[model samples]
Each structure stands twice: as C-alpha cells, then as structure tokens.
Target: MSNATPPGWYPDASAPGTDRWWDGTAWTAHTRPAAQAPQAFGPPEPFTAASGDATTAARSGTRIAALAVAGLMVVGAAVTGAVLLGRDDDPARPEAGPSGSAPPSTTATATPSPDGSPAGNDPEVLVDQLNGITLPIPDGWEKPDRTVEPVPTMRTVDPYECPGSSSDFCYHATVTSRTASATDITSAEQLARQDITAAADRAYEKNIVGNRIHGGITSHDQLDSAPVSVAGRAGYQVRWRVNTAKGPGGYVQSLVFPSTVGSESLIIVRYAFDAGPDGPPLSLMDTLTKGIRPIGDSATSGGVGSSIAP
Candidate 1:
C-alpha cells in the first residue's frame, strides 16, 4: 500500500468537524458528516513504477510540497499589516516600509543646526500633536510628510551618517498612537502582542512569496515582551527585528496601555526607526519616550528644543 493517505474522506483544512473529499491531487467541495464517513475515503493513486528510486522520488516530492504549504501559512500570519508605515510600492506587491532617504542635496543637510537648546533637552514642547498626545521633538530634527496608520507623526534627524561610511541618509523616526477595541481584550500586554503580530503578519504576506517551501522571513528576532507604565497606566512593550522587502526593519519598540472612562480604551505607541546603522542613536528613542505627555496634564508646556544638538 502507498504511504499517501488515499483520497475519499478527510478532515477539511479550512473547516473543522466537516469531512471533504480529496481526489488525490486536490480537495473537492463535497462534504458529509464526519461521523457518517466511511473509513476508506478512496483508493490511493497507483505507482507507475515499482522501482525503489521512483517511490523515493515520489515521497520526496510530496514532502517538499507539504513543507511549502506549511511555510506559506507561517509567513502569511506574520507579514500581515506590517508595512503600515507607508504605501510606496507596486499595488500588486506588499507596501514597503517608510523610506527616509536623504532628499536631494538641495533640500537641506541631513542634520540641520539647532534652533535653540540642544536636542533632547527642552521639555516644554510638542511635535505633531494629535489625539490629545504630544512628543518632545529633539533638536536638529524636522517634521516631515510621514504618517502611518493609527495617527503617525514623523521627525527626521539629518546628517545621520550611514553605517560604515561617511555618507548619511535622513534618519526617520515616527511615533503613532491609536485606540483599539477592548472587546475580548483582557490585558494591555495582549493588545501590544496582537498589534505587533498583526504588523508582522501583514509585512510577511506582502513580501514573502506565496510559494511556501521556497519563501519565508529572510531573517527575524523578537525581544522579550515586558510590562511598562505609560501616562500613569499599566501597559506592555515589545520589540522585534526582521529583514523586510526594502531591507532590515522592525518595530524598534512599541507600547500598549489601557484607560477606562466609559468603556475600555486601549492606547498604543509605536516607535519605528528605519535608518539601520545610519539611524539615530537608540538614546534618542529613550528621550522621546520619556518626554511624551498627554495634553492638558501639565501647567506650563515645554519650550521648543533645537533639532541640532549643540
């Protein structure tokens, strides 16, 4: 008898508890109650040759096909909605992450001179204010036309020298916050994980080839998820890295917190940096995160800080 499970009756991959007919090569729409199906679904396809080499090759092909399907499923789940950063791509392909290449030399130096105080110092300020929240724009950084879902605000640090070279690309930094439905969401950590997972799944679907066995995440790693406090509320944070269609990209860091007024309102902060080795120093991310504050919570707002650190 062939090792292959003969077609006739098999559990449907898509629907649980329902039996579907497998005509050896593909599944048929025919269905019947699982309990009512006979033990034998159908006879296995006969081997054309009895030689050992032929049987081995046949089994190898089947295994390879199965592996391909498994890979596709994993990639599909991870890449969905990950490219929420921007929509600069062929509509047929997944959207690539935000591109922060230095504008034409005529635009301005990658790093501009500070307006006043050094970057990350002046706290009484706000950049790209929205949703009753604000960010502390560091010195030498400039607001650019970059936005992503859930209300994105982008600030770029110019003169950011690219890795291993003297050249620089406008380093892109973005902060976005959005409220998600709390229905069935038990904890803030869960919310953060869900969002990150969704982003990854979206990215994978768009970038990875549908052919499962041959395509998947180029490379990826995720840091441990941790608990955090945001605006006096319990929250969670998660970080991960993966190679994207454009290049290496991932959520440098993300936070999710919840508030209760009438119903549960989950707030999320997603911080993304796309410049790689030429990217802004990680310390800058710390400064901005510490400086974020909900509007109307402070008496005197912070002063505008210089983008260029003096």
Candidate 2:
C-alpha cells in the first residue's frame, strides 16, 4: 500500500461481494457485504402484484412510493431495464423500474413562442428525431431547455427539491420520449410491459444517482396494460400506481411502439405524476396519449387506448 492511499473502503481482492476497509495503507480484515447496486441498476425480476386498487387513498398508506421523473423514471429510467410490480426487498437500494438510466436526447431549446412548442424550429412541437414522432406540449406544460438536462421531455412544473430527500429533485409531472432498442427483436407489448417497471423503479424508487426521491417505493399495482398505437403505428402500454413510503406517491406509465424512421427501432414514452389531490388528474395520461401525432402530420389521437380512472 502507498503512503497516501486515502483512508476509505475498497473492494477486497481476496473476497467477493464484500468491501474491505483501508485505514490508510494496509487493508483491514473487516469486511461487509458489497452494495447490491453500486452503479447502473441491474434488470430486476418482475415484481408481484400489490393488493389494492389504484386510488388517491392508496397514497395514504405507508407504502414506499418510487420509481421517477429518473424521476420517479424521470421517464428516462423507464426506457431502460428493471423489475416490475414486485416488492423491493432492499429499501436502501431501491429496485429498478424506471430503472436507472438515460439522459434525454439532445435538442434545440428555444423560448416558447406564442404557440408554445419547446423544441427545434417548431414553436408548437417537440420532435423526437430518434423515434420519428412528435409529442404535443399540452396546456400548462413546457418543453424544458435541452441544455438543462438531456431528456427530450415536457414538464408541468419546474424542477424542485424532493419533499422526502433534499439530495434529490422532482417534477410533479413529466413525460419523456425515447427509443428503447434498435437491435433487439421484440413485440411492442412485451417491451412496454418490461420497460414500465423500470421506469417506475428508476424514477420514484430512486433516481439514477440512487436517491429515493419519494421515500422509496414499497409496492405497485398494474393499473392498465393494453394494445394501442402511436403516431398511427402499432403500440402497447402499461401503467402502474407505484406506492411510496413518504410524500404523495405517484403514477407512472410506459408506452412502446416501433419508430417510423430508420430500421423501425422500438420507441418508448414514459409518464410520471404525483398521487393525491395536489397532483395532476390521471385523465391527463389519456389526454396526452391521444395527443401524440406524426411529425409534419396534422392528425392527433393515434388510436384507441386504455385510460387510468381517478
């Protein structure tokens, strides 16, 4: 050991799944179990169903509210991988759902024109070039400045400190869009089902940085999962009302479809909204889903889809 090896813990070469402490120079025999999730969130096993209808009162119970905006899936986490509808065994390392994650795509951010669109040259639209679709910036929402964060999303409120933990921040409502996989071969239904779990985990359970923003997720109910369409293309969706241990837990959804551009890469859109009276009405999910349309195409309301009841 060097004279100045900084006093701290380091992975033990002699042991696996354990950390050895280094007082400064020599390694100490004292060891502890290695952190289950020290960095990137691993894809967790599918979670079992929780007993309860998705309701406002559901937030009152002491269930852990997880999964993000990375954020309770900031929507970004959902695009990645993680567990679904399962109970998180370890509260310290929240299980992946939105699944810790990805930075939003790079886009040109400009002042909202009178029409109020938040990306590129279109004053009324945010174009997701990777997915070859457009997401309408509904009333009371604004496209965030692309430079502030890489996510290609719209937010109902500005970023604010998390109510549960000061180290983390949150968005009362957020919708993120991205492409899931260009190389994988899978049906949209399967992809959406898998991704939403991660989204809920990554966003609310704990952000990519591993901060449990909503007091950490305890359980979730699969509110809805159904076939649908986006931008006139075949798609599917899964919605869950994730219960947290603190604050007003929230609802998160993942919608998957094939992109129109390139080789038809799969596209996923994630949504997160706080639970209780302070949060946006759940119908907004249906309203936003109906608002998606193809870029340069005027038609909205891609097709019939499931709705979350109040």
Candidate 3:
C-alpha cells in the first residue's frame, strides 16, 4: 500500500450521509449510504514503509498549506470596490496579545482573534480586535468588507480606478488602523511626525505598481501637529497638505496612541483624503479621532477626549 488513502469509501464532503469511493488520490463518482461504508475516513490501511516518513511529510505539507491560506491580508486600493486605506506596505509589528498572537511580521496584516472569524459589519464603528480599539465610522463611510480579512478600516464613497492605473483602485478618503512597530520606545509625537511622509506617499503619490496615479506628490506642508489624548491615552497627531502633479492632491495624517487592552503596545491610525471640493471635510479627522474607544463585550462609547493628558 502507498501513503495515499488506500482505495476505499469515504464520506462525501458535498453530500451528507453518503460515502464516495476514494480512488487513492481523489473521489470517484461511486456513492452509497454511509451505513454501508466499511472504513472510517482518515489514514488508510498501513503502508509498506515502517518508518512512515511519506505520511509524516504529506501531513506536514497539508498543515503548511492551510496556514498560508489563513495569513493573507487585504490592502484596500488593491481590490475593487474596497473603500478603505490602500498602501503597498505598512511599517508595522505583529499585534501583541496574551496568547502571543501576531500577524505576518512588518505588514501588520491584522490577524483575526484566535477565533479567526469575521466580526461582521457594525453600522457605527469599525472594531480592531487585535488592537482592542474601535473607530467610529461616519454615516457615508463604507464599512469593513467582512468578506476580506477583518482589518479595521472604513472610507468615503465607493472605490474607483486610478486615473491612469486601471490595475489599481482609488478612494477619495480612507482611514486605517494597525499596531505600530515595538522595537523602540518613541513618543506619539515623534512617531506621527516620522510617519506623515510615508502616509502621504502611500495615499496619492503612486499606484501599487509605481504608476503615477495622482501624477505624484509635488510638495507637502504641515497643517497641524499637536499632543492629544486618544482612547484615554497620551497621544499625538500630525497632518499634512500634499500637492500632486496631476489630480487634486490630498491631506494625510498619522495619529498614534496606546492600545487600552492587552500589552498596551502603540496603535497607529492613518487618514488620507483627496483635496478637491468633493473630498472629505478636514473636520472629519477630528471627529473620527474623538470617537476612538476601547472594545469589549460591554464597552460603551465614552468619546475619546482631545486633551494632552489622559
């Protein structure tokens, strides 16, 4: 016998209570009532190799493949009709948790809770389970796409193709949430200042493939930099008005604060909006930031304060 399940009958995954014949590698059309099937589904009769190396290798391969499927993250602009923040990459660290839960290294691709299930659409807020924080979603913002991995995000309007980069999509405004890198201890002010440039670039400079979507950022000016409280934690935010070579450039802001739950690692929220008259109102930034709250089964919205002290 080989490592493959010996030719036998196994339960049909598609049809309940029926067993389908397994011709070793795949299921044959033959089916019969489960009561008539002889062997239970699983490893077949003992193979010739006593060492069992082939079976062990096959099982290991299967496990790796499954893990790979579970770890993918979605970048908003990368997909069609996704009205959330879009970036080729984010400088992030895996989310810290009690069970040591984390996502793929620097990408900060939010790993679902150990339950690993979609949290579903909340009409008013987007929950970041990994960060233990919730962001208020304005009325017109597109809710997180439950079909994609649950990364905390929301944006204004439906998505559209980049002016020239048809392969990628664009959003007039988008907000995103994720854990910040933990390698060094840095104040929220420093982190936010350092991040605005990258935030601006990711939003309007170019498409994922280096195609100039908004032509390219021609210049940028600091609009605001201030100390603020976030989710009851001392935090800071920086905003910029970027000029683009083609379309109406946009404003980008980086806000950093501490997570109220678990390890208390830093959390970063990014916002990007087009600058034309149709773009989102600049006041929306302060509104969303003020709505940040901790998430829990019985959590209530206290309304994040804007003071420098907690």
Candidate 4:
C-alpha cells in the first residue's frame, strides 16, 4: 500500500488509540498513544485539550489550565516547538499571524530577582528613580537624552537602529507614572491599557506609526490584555498593533504596575517596537521584561519571585 499524506503523524492503521509516524515516503515503526489533541507529551493527559486550542481567544483567557504547562514542551518537531508555544502571534516575528493579531501569550511568567533594588550601577539596565521602575536594557541601546526631563524616554533600543529618524523607523521605550485616585482606574490592568492606548494615540497622531487596518488613527487593534503581577505587586498588561511606514510595523506591549512609593501612584512600563514580519521581533523586549525589577522594596527577598496573575 502507498501513503501520500505528507510526512506527519497519522492515525495508526492497526491501532485504534494510536498515531503512527509517516516519514513522507513510508510509515515508520514509531507509534505513540493518541488522543483528540496531538501534543508532544507521552501518555495523554487531561490538560492537552486546552493547550491544543491555544490559538483561540478563549484558550488565552483560561491560561492556567494544567495542560498549558506542556504548552512549552520542546519535543519531536522544531517547527511545532518554535511556532505553537512559548510566545505566539508576535507581530514582529516572521511567523506572526495576520495583521492586528496579538501574541498568544497573555500573561508573562515573572522570574524573581534579588531583594531591595538590583545592582543599579550595571550599564545594561536603566533605572527610573522617579517611578522606581527598572528595565534591563540590551547592549548597544542608546540612552534617552538626559534633558528629556519629566517623561523619560529611551530611543534606539529597538533592534532596528535608525540614526536620526528614531521617530519613524525605530521604537522607543518610555516610563510614565501618574497619580491614581480611587475613581481614576478600577484595576491596575485598566490603567496600564489606557496608558498603552494613549501612547499609541500620540504615535498615530504624530505620525510615529500609521493607523491600524480596521482601527482609525489614534485607535488601535487590541490583540490581548490582562491583569498580571510583577515584583510582587498588582499589574496590568496590553498588546496591540498599528500600521507603520514600513508596512505592518506596529506591535506595542505595556506592563503597568504600582509604584514603590505608594498605591496611589502607578508605573507604566511601555514597550514599543516594529511588529513587521521583517527585522527582529519582541524576543529582546521579552528578555527585558523578564529581567525587570524594583530598585527598593524591603519586602522583596533574595530568592527568585514567582510570577502570578492577580
């Protein structure tokens, strides 16, 4: 018998609850126990259902499903490992989904750092004394002008460095903090998202980035937004995209958390980048976010902090 189903896992001809490997040319002896969802785990578990549906919006809402642990499984296929899990739908990545799509990862897994402020002297990191927010900047990233005053902005941190045209080709990271009243925002997530939208509005109105396909100028296509915790505090995050001079190059993500000074103040850690299919993606920004830490907090201990969604 001949099989022309392309090289992939197919229902085993002889076994009812199993899948056999088809090596493009012929069926191989390799067989594994099968279920409705073909995951990279051995012995099907109850959670594979949710992880298999990770592409859908509903799956992202229910991020804590036990099977999601296996979502990052680096198994059998490189394409599967690279595409399906970790962070999917990044506009900056070559594998990003259609326009106005958000990354599949709604929540960031917080990796804890040492207690009471990171070693501030390290040049790789940028610390905001006013807001008490610290960012682990990548190498070669030029610092924001010392004279930018009040609103601190870091330019040319993007993988695409444009010599004087930062306002157009490259992305800028800005730290904005504001006084929050009880009625100002209901949740940390709301505040963060508002700040993100505000940033996008400024960019679009100023021609920093172009308008999104379905959304008007100063408006954006929100891919995903959720409440998350970073540095042991309540936080909110949003991911969105807009049009840019370079095709579809607007992918923006912002993490908003409380300032160390008091609950009344909120800090917005905004990441702006080119989400186009070309150039580098948000991987560098992800690395920066994972390394974010607070400069002063006695409650923070030396051990790594676990990331949790509040």
RMSD of each: 22.9, 21.2, 19.2, 23.2
Off by over 4 Å in 1: 1-131, 144-150, 157-171, 200-217, 245-251, 259-264, 299-310
Per-residue alpha-carbon lDDT of candidate 1 for residues 201-263, written as tens digits (9 for 90 to 100): 433323122222102246657865888766566778876665554444544566777542212
Winner of 2 and 4 under TM-score = 2
Instruction: Residues 108-163, candidate 4: write the lDDT tens digits.
Output: 22111121122223344455544445555554454443422234344454434332
Q: Could you give the candidate ranking by TM-score, starting with the highest? A: 3, 2, 4, 1
- Measured by TM-score, the strongest candidate is 3
Tens-place lDDT per residue, model 2, 1-310, is 1012222333443455454433323333334445433322221221212422212221222223344322145645544444334443442322222222211211112232211233244434556644447776665666656533344677765677876888777878888887674436469998888898789987788787777777889889999999986767888999999889888789999998877753466778899998887678988888777767665564444321222222
- For model 1, what is the C-alpha lDDT against the true structure? 0.43
State the lDDT at 290 in candidate 4: 60
lDDT by residue (1-310, candidate 3, tens digit) is 2123333444544566654443334333344555442232242222222434423322332211011122334764332332332332211211111111122210123223321223333456576655667777676676545423234667776787765566777888888887676347567788888888878887888654566777778889999999988878999999999998877888899999987754466778999988888688888888788788876534555332233121
Model 2 weakest 10-residue run by lDDT: 99-108
TM-score of 1: 0.44
- The whole-model lDDT of each prediction reads 0.43, 0.59, 0.60, 0.44
Choose the strongest candidate by lDDT. 3
Task: Report the Cα lDDT for residue 7, model 4.
Answer: 29
lDDT (C-alpha) at residue 50 in model 3: 42
* Backbone clash count for every predicted candidate, in the order shown: 32, 52, 0, 2
TM-score of each: 0.44, 0.57, 0.58, 0.45
